[model samples]
Every structure is written in C-alpha cells, then in structure tokens.
Target chain A: MLDSESPTKSPMKTGESATRATTRDRLAAASLWLPVVILSVTATLWSRRLPAELPVEWLGNEGGAFRSTAVFSGITGTFALFAAVAGIIALAGVAATIRPWLVLVAGMVGGSATAAWLVAAGFGLAGEPMPASAVPWMVALVLAAASYGVVPYLLSSRQRRVRLGDAAAGVPLGVGEAGAWFTTIRVRVFGVFAAVSTLAAAVIAVLLVPRDAVGASAAIVALLLVAAGFLVFSRLRVSVDHRGLRVVSSLFRFPIAHVELNRIVSARSAELRAAEWGGWGYRVMPGRTAIVVSGRRGILVERDNGTHFAVTVPNPDLPVALLTTLVSR
Target chain B: MLYKVDPASAVTIADQLAVQVRVAVADGSLAPGTRLPPARELANALSINMHTVLRAYAQLRDDGILEMRQGRGASVRADAAAGTVRLVELADALLAEARKLGVGIPDVLILIQKRGTHA
Candidate 1:
C-alpha cells in the first residue's frame, strides 16, 4: 500500500488556503497549456484568411493541386485539435493527475499540427508554389515550442506542498511523536551527463538523416529524453512514515517503490557499485530493485517476502539507522 | 507529527509513549478526532512489544483521551482537549495542596484510599 502521509496531496487546507491553492494550480495548468492554445488560435485565424482552395498535394517540383475540401478539413482539424488538447490539460490539472510527459506530447503534436496548417495557409494566401524551404522552418518551430514548454511546467509543479489533513492518517501515534521522514535528492552531475548525451545523439542523428521530418522527429525525441532525464536523474525523493518507505521522482511525484516497514526483515548500510547493479537510474534484476545514482553508499533492505531494495543516497547512515531501528522494533 | 521512544532510556517504553501522547493532547499538537498510528506499527517503529504500545493506547483510552475499535485504529476523542485540560487543573490543585500541607504523594494516596475503603 502507498504511504499514508505521502506528499501527493496539496498541503493547502480548507477555507482561504484551499482557495488560494486551487487558484495557483489552475494558473500553473494554464501556463502549461498556453503554447498549445496560442498555436491553436493562430492556426484558426490563419486558416480563415486562406483562400477557398488549399494545396493538398504537390503534383511536381513546380506545381500542386488545390482542393476546397482540404481547406475546410484543415480549419476543422485545427479547432478539434485545440479542443482535445485543452480538455486533456484541464482535466489533468483539476484532478491533479497531470504527467510531465503528457504535457510534452500534447505540446509537440499540437504545435506541429498547428504549424503545418499555418504554413499551408500561408502558401494559400501568398498564391506561391509550395517550396521545400518551409518544411525546415515548420519542423524547427514545433521542436522549439515542445521542448521549451515542458521546463516551466515541471519547475512550477514542484513547488506544490502536501498538507497533513489531506492525507488519510494510516495509524495513530503517541502524541508529539514524529511519524514520517521525507527528503529530496538531486544528482546534478548525472543529470547533466544524460542531458548532454541526449542532445549530442540528436545532433548526430540529424546529420546522418537529412530529411526534414526525420530530423524533426529526432529533435523531439532528444528533447523528450532531456526533459525526462532532468526529472528522473535530477531529483529523487525518499519518504519513510508509518505506512511505508516511498521513493519517488520529484518531477512526477510518482513512486519508484513503496516498501512497508513491517514487511522489512532487515536493513543495513552497504557499498553500492553501478557496475554490479547494471548501471543507472532505476535497475531491476531478479528479486532486487536498485535506485543507484552518484554515490556508492546505500541502504540495503531485505523484505520478509525475499525481495531486496537498495537506494544510493549521499548519506545513508541516518536512513539506515532509522530503518534498522524500525525493522528491529 | 513525530513519535519516538528510546528503548535504552530508563523509563519504560509504555510510560514514555503514554506521556508523549498526553503531552501532545494537552498542547493541542494532536487535534481532536485525529487518527493515531496503529499499535503494531508504532511498536515496530519503536522496537518495542506490540502489547506495550497497546498498553499505552489503553491508558489513553481509559482517560477519555482516545477512542479505539477493532479494525479501526485509535483516534483522539472529541472531548479529549477538555478532558486533558480538566486533568491538568486537578493535578495542579492536588500538587499545590499536598505541598502546602507537607504531605507526600504516597500519604495523599493512602488518605484517599482509606476514605474510599471506609465509604
């Protein structure tokens, strides 16, 4: 079961606090969806200004065929795309289920579609033959918007606090007793390495495959990886409370593992090597899962069910001591 | 909030746990109707016997400070604050009266017991 006092709930309480928190959450959601909304509006406006016919397909290097159906479809498609993206963002935000990747995907797809439609509309308005040059600009615009949009959303959402009243108290404790321990760890060196590697790989791929679409797709993949790497490798949060020990990625606040303290048979400090664990972020081998990043010191917890869990943190002594004391008790 | 019990301390774990709970209730750190950690979990965390934790919880329940039911963990009683306040007031008055009369706690207890037995 999940930890009873996990930081998933908003810290803001009822009355004035709740109202202020809700407003802040909504504003954050709006900021995340702003790029998509702006592109959608721009697409709609551009589509209206286009001539009755739109170039659907290029017949040759110099000429292309125009279809009135294509123009209407583009306009309708733009509106539908905006509505769908807006609805998803709104629901995710209000329900507090918003995932960073989901927003990134929405931004990429929405931005790309909007940009494509806008380019075609621009061609229709200018009465110029479709040119190859426009493709690169369109691809670059989409990639840039999608990549940059994720950063602010991720940063803003991390500021949200978890309140005690919002959580279902797992069990009663003696008054004046501490029932939980929580901390977030950021591995700066590893995150930077991962981000740089992703960008380098994207650059190499673009050089190898000169096609506009391929380059754009590669750029999108690279950006997504960089964003995900920043979230996964940069900040890891560990929480131990009455319910269990929860390790989560700070960006998504999604649990990497939730281990019940009762089920833990033993816990001790151990020297962890990335080579032994098959390297990196989160590794699962056989009956063991290891969260290894940077440091070589970690706490190895053996569960009653015969499974093992290890997490490498800078200072594992306190966590190990706490875990050992709890398990032994 | 935080709950802690030092196994190496001179005080019994049960007494330590009970004192902590009483102090928290008296100070309003634990609001009325707040569910407490389960006895089993508390015992595990403190490295003490589950029965010891239960004993502490029972002490609180008897004082009208907590409510416990099977399957549902312990929670602070709705009137626990008022109950705790009254307890403190009576304890202070008793302590002051005993001090003024140069009577020990044992003597006071014996006097009360003698009166109860005769009645």
Candidate 2:
C-alpha cells in the first residue's frame, strides 16, 4: 500500500546518466567459472599420482594418515563434488542477491586445503604421525573468512559513487520549526533463531554440568550465548531529522546506513514482505538495497542518482513524512 | 502512533505529546494496556528534553490514561475510560475549528456554554 507518495514524474530524467553495474564487475564475477574447469582437469591428473586407497578422514587425532582408507576414485570424486558445488553457487549468483564469486572462493578454499591432506597421504606421507596437515586447513579458513569481505570490495560493483538528486519534499516546517521521528524495529526472524540457538546451548550445559570441569562447560555455554547474540543480527534504531535518515544498531549504536536528505528523490511508506526483497538483514540487488527486519511497515527511498534504498521500520509514516519534508527543502 | 512536535507551535511539548497519546487512544491504535516507549527513548529520538517527556507522562497519569511504576515504565491503564478520550478528541476538533476561524478558547467556551445549556 502506498501512502503519502510523491507525484509521478517522467520515467527518466532528461539529463540523467543511467547508473548500473559495470561490465568489469560481471566479468570478474563470472570469471570464477574458469577455476572449476581448471580444477576438474587438475584433480583428474592428481589422482594418477595417488595410491589405490585414501584416508577416510583428513583431520583425525594424528591427522588423516591415522584414519581408515578409501578407494582412490572415492577421494577424487569427493574433491570434484566440492568443486561442482562451488560452480553451482557461481552460476546461481547472477540471479540472486548472494554474490557468486565470494561463495565459490570459500568452497574452493575449503576443498583445496582438504585435498592437500589427501594428496599428502597418497604420496608416502601416509603414516608416522602427519599432524602438520591441520595447518593448511586453518590457514585456508582464515583466508576464506578474509575473502568474504576482501573479494567483494576488490571485484564487485556493490558500492557505486552516488551524486545528489533533486529531492522531493511535501510536509512543511515553519520558520525556526524542526521535526524528528524515531522507531526501533526488532527483527523477529533473527530473534527467534537466536533464542532457539541459545536454548539448545542451555540444554547442552544442563546435561554436561553434572560432569567435572565446570570451567570448560561454562566456557562452552558462554561461547554459545555470544554466538546467539550475534545471530540476533541487530535491533535497528531508525531516525529521520534535519540530518536525513539514519539507521543504527541498538547494541553498538553504530551507524548501519544513512541517506543524506540531498540525495533523496522521494520517499513513501510501503507494506513490504521481507522474503520478496531477498530475506531479512541487509540485501543488495542491482541498483537497490533493502534493510528488512520483522517486515511490514517499510520506507522506500528513491535516490537522485537512480538508486533506491528501502528500510523496514515499526512505524514508517513519521519517517516518511519527515524525510519527504526534508528532501523537499 | 504518530508522534510529532513543533517547537514553534503555541502548544507546550508535553501537551503535544499527551494529546497525541489521547488521539491515539481515541482512534484505538494505542489499545488499552499497550506500553508506550520509555520517556528517555522517546526524548532521545525527538532530540527533546527527557523531562519534557516525563511531564507528558505525568499529565497522562493524572488524566487516568496511563499507569507508571518505578521500574516497569508506563502503559495505558486497562480501565482508562473511553469517555475521556472521546472528550479529548472532541475538544481537539473544536479547538482546531476555532483556531481556523480566528477565534480563541474563551470564545469557543462561551459558544459551548450557550449550546451545551440549550441541549
């Protein structure tokens, strides 16, 4: 439902340049496919260097060499399976909000490191305590975590430079008059997940508390609670005033997103379904991104530079009214 | 509920807030027993003095529209009479019409007295 929406104007402003993802971005993301074929061939060749059987698990107490063996083809098939999974993610990324390249890199990072342990075992490092195989796995994990952020910044067109637009304003403020609106949205989706996760952790502690080593049990419980807290994603505090629209996290009070008044073209209250806009949390599409939570009352803000940013809030009318007023000024 | 304040307006900030609550109560948006945002949170959001919000709460409590406790924050009283809210809304409409017609509350009161006594 649209309320207090601005009057429709021409579909495209006459002097405006079209904003979009660059060719470089699409190619850089799609280029990830090359590795899939390359790895397929490489893994086929690597199996020839291996023996007739392989370690059943890569990270046993003394590492993979200590575990039971599996046929050589089985090991190669497993490695190829992971590579195929990564390729599928890359292919699907073009149509969805999830970045294809980032997920593919993560899959490869995990697949290749585990492959290293299997390769080491086949080439006569099969026995005599190969504990060091764990090192490459850990290193791969760190790299994968870092690349979640690094690869997107280096190769994607996620954050494009934006210029001011001719904003729309309607609500009037008299001379020396100012208005501000505020609301907090609790993300029920993430909150329920967090609660369930915490409850599971609590049940685990209850079962384990009867045993000795209270310190270890307590540590595990604490770690799980912290993870649950993170799972909350965030309680978003949104406000609109003379400074424009600001969204901040309730936990850290850190600014999650902001749109300056000068950059806003128009704004209106909407009834949004979070699933339709790409799941809860911050979602980025071609030229728009939406921050959705419990997901009903939302504000859709169209920016001057041909981009849009939407946020789900508990009470969107006040902000929509305030933003429309400020943008018009 | 929609809450807004115009510092330049003749109405005090507290009265603006209290009236918004009354209007919301009358419209049935703020249901009986619904909890209102804490005064500090409201103040922080609007960039207004915290005491101003407290004063609004105090007025609401005196009007029997809200219940406040030391630790539980504030909520609309379950028994908050509808007649009071209806009167508040009617008074608001009358005051608005009077303001638009370039008349004062005393003039409206005089007219109300003349009409009220007749009815």
Candidate 3:
C-alpha cells in the first residue's frame, strides 16, 4: 500500500497544492514548457538543415569514437511515431480523469520533449557523431530536464478550487484554553524499499560492480535516484493549533501547506480511501487535494481559499477537536 | 498523538509534552520504536525553546517512556505502552480528585512518594 512510485503512476496523482486552473498558471506552464518547445522546434529545424544522414558515433571501440552515418529522419520518424502512440494512450487514459489539463500536458510533453532534446542537444551541433564521451553529458541533460519538469509540476500543484461542502463547526473552546496537535507518519513499505535499493546500489558500487567507467557511473546514477526516492518516500509531520494547520513533509522540508486560522473555514474527520486520491503521496484533483498515507482516517481542512487539504494520520480525534475548538473561537 | 503545550495553561510546557507521550503510547498513536522529531525541530514547530523540548524528552527518558540516542533523536520505548496507559489514566483521575480536594501538586507528589515507599 505504501508503494506510490510505480512505472505507471495514476494520472490522477498530482501536486499537493491544487490551485484552481487559471491563466496565470497556464502562463507559468508555458514559460516552463518554453525550453522544451524550443528544443522540439529547433531539433526539427536542424533535421531539415542537415544533409540526408546524421553522423552517428560508436564509442565501444577501445581507442576513439568510430564515425558511422545513420538517417536522422529515421530517429525523428521513430520519435514522431512514439509521440503519436503515447499521445493517444495519454489522451485516452489521463486527459479524461486528470484535473487542470496542464498536468496532462506536462506528462505528455515533458516526456517526449526530454527524449527529443536528449538527442538534439547532443548531436545536433556536434556534426561529428557522438562518442562514449558525449554519453555523460546526455545523461546530465536528461536529469536536468527531469528536475525542470518537477518545478512546473510543483508550481501547478499550488492552488485549486475544492467543492465547499456543508460547513461543520469546530469544537468549542473554553476561555484560556489553548492546545496543539502533532503527529509524524513515516512510510514503512516504501522506506524499506528505498533503503534496500540504496543499499544494493552502494553494495554494487563498492563490492561487486567493476570499477569501469560505465559500471561505476551507472551505479552512481542509481544511487542518486535512490537518494531522491528516500526523500520523496520519507516521513511527514503534522500539527494543528492556534497557528492553524501545518504539514511538513520530509521531502527536502517541503512544506505541503501552512493554512492559517483566519483562512480556514472548517475542518472534519473523514475516511480517505485511496481510490478517491488516485494513489498515495500527495494527490490533487479538481475538488480535493490529499497527502495520503497509512491508517486512512484523517482530518480534512477547508481553507478560506476554497481549497481543501486532507492528510492521513493514525489518530484524528484530538486534532479534529483542536482545530474545531480553535476555529470556533 | 497530538503534542500540545499551552503557555497560558497551569501545566508547564515540559510536563505537557511528556504527558502527551504517555497518552500517545497508551492510545497506540505512537507505537514502539517510533522516532520522535528532534527537540530542535519540534521546538521550531511549536514556537518554543529547544531546551524546553529537551527537558520534556529527558523527563520521558528518565521515566522509561522514551529512549534517546545521540543522533537518532527519541523514540517510544517498546515496553512503555500498556503500563503507561494505566499510569496516565490513574494520574488523570488523581489530578481530577486532587483538584476536587483542593490538594496542591507538591502534596500529591509527597503522597505518591509515601505510597511508593510502602509498596
């Protein structure tokens, strides 16, 4: 149940902050997607400018990169075909269910764009075929693009309109009564999985994998990803008090939300099924956003901004009452 | 379990934190081996001094509610759950009764010490 990161993520999985779909957000999306769009257009332009074939380099030879010619049209044609197929699948599977469309765009465009740019950035200007030497830079480019994709996703996850259901009153507070609620939830299964992979990568690098450049570099990339997985799949800390509701995930101390009291309309305890949330971690839909984890039962906080945030925790009674009391006063 | 401390309340912040640990253990919100947030981090969250959180965690460690390590922060003791629940319940009842009887906290402690020696 703790496994949120499979190869195929539910398209419904979204940013924690599901800000309403707005022109401003779309502008930001355009800005972020700008680089990819440029790369795509530029790559095609270069393909047209280049002669019939691209100079492909085979670096496997012990001494130097062997220059071999391959048809640029073939690679470009394959990419176009792949993009079409992926477009169809994503449109069929993701567009119908995903909220705010831009996420779907990011999923589709971000992927193929990275694929296109990886090739174009490497060999487009080089004129000479790429060698084993160029492979490292290609890897770096892919990583850079992936991290760039995350930034826009994080931005888009910022705000959304939630269905304002019947408002519930908070627990009444007595005079001079003050309280705070705190809980930390860690992912058991995912954490273990990350730990195992991290250990395996370290072991392979240190003990088993030969010290060759490719082997060591592959191990390092695996280690880097595992490190990121550790952060993403780590723990979350929650507290609600006079300060309103606060959630801090261990993802580089990424604050999921810091909803203030005056901005909060109401709060209630509810059973959050995973089905409603797509899959675990932080999920965003048109009407809801959730930081889901174990125990399923959690407190839902409705903000003055008309967005609702749900977080999973073992015990909700005290926090619910605490939020209730604080809000009622 | 919610860790709440009200400066405006009669109870000290340290005791508020320490007692919350027992209640959490008692109620199973914090299971055995659950790693508590470091004193500094939790203090920042609660807007209190780091030392206050340290004092609370130190007291819990002394009473066997938690185990503190140099770098790993504090965690609930494995055997502290069942016993601490009953202890917390009795303590709550005792405090309520003490309030009704107008008995001061110092006197309650002295009474417990006397009872402890006899038992």
What digit string (tens of lDDT, one per residue) describes model 3 on residues A251-282? 45667767788887887666666654566777
Better of 2 and 3 by lDDT: 3
> DockQ (C-alpha) of model 3?
0.17
DockQ of 2: 0.25
Query: Which one is best on DockQ?
Result: 2
Better of 1 and 3 by lDDT: 3
Q: What is the lDDT of residue A279 in candidate 2?
A: 66
Locate the minimum summed-lDDT window of 10 residues in model 1 chain A. A160-169
Residues A1-329 of candidate 2 have per-residue lDDT tens digits of 11223332212122122223455445545443443454456556665554544443333334443343333334444554554455344334232334433444545553454454445444333434324665566445534533433342355455432222333334555655556665566566676676776776777677766676557576667768765555545566677776677787765557788988788878876555554456667878667778877656577788899887888876565567668877777
* DockQ of all models, two decimals each: 0.05, 0.25, 0.17
- Name the weakest run of 10 consecutive residues (lDDT summed) in model 2 chain B: B22-31
Predictions in order: lDDT: 0.60, 0.61, 0.62
True contacts kept of each: 0.11, 0.22, 0.31
Docking class of 1: incorrect
TM-score of chain A of each: 0.42, 0.56, 0.48
